[model samples]
Target: QVYVNGELIGGCDITLEMFERGELQPLVEAAVKVQEGNQQA
Candidate 1:
């Protein structure tokens, strides 16, 4: 299973699909950025 921002993203196949389309990195980066900002606050 996979999740982002507490939302479901699905399992390994779906995750691989996102990675293949080059969406995973930016999604992870944005999630990290939000987490960082939340920590700062």
Candidate 2:
């Protein structure tokens, strides 16, 4: 499973498919944005 900030985002089966379709990049980018926002806050 994939976890972001200790929250489950998806499972390996779906995540792998997303990775193949290049869909996971956006999720990772959003996670980074959220982390940066939290740090700034």
Candidate 3:
């Protein structure tokens, strides 16, 4: 299973689908940005 920020993203197939659709990177980037913002707060 894949997770981000304690939220379940999905299993391998769903993650692969998102990668194929060019979504995963942006999602990860957004998640990282949010985490960084939280850290700075």
- Residue-level lDDT tens digits of model 3 in 1-41: 99977789999999999999999999999899999999999
Instruction: Please give the RMSD of candidate 1 to the true structure.
Output: 0.7
Query: Listing every candidate in turn, what is its Cα RMSD in Å to the true structure after a full C-alpha superposition?
Result: 0.7, 1.6, 0.9
Q: What total of clashing residue pairs does each candidate reach?
A: 0, 0, 0
Tens-digit lDDT string for candidate 2 (1-41): 89866667689998898889998888888889999999999
User: Global lDDT of each model?
Assistant: 0.91, 0.86, 0.93
Candidate 3 residue-wise lDDT at 24: 92
Q: Compared with the true structure, what per-residue lDDT tens digits does model 1 show for residues 1-41?
A: 99987778889999999999998889989899999999999
Where does candidate 1 clash, by residue pair? none
lDDT against true structure, model 2: 0.86
- The residue ranges of model 3 lying beyond 4 angstroms of the native Cα positions read none
- Mark the 10 consecutive residues where model 3 has the least summed lDDT: 1-10
Deviation from truth (RMSD, Å), model 2: 1.6
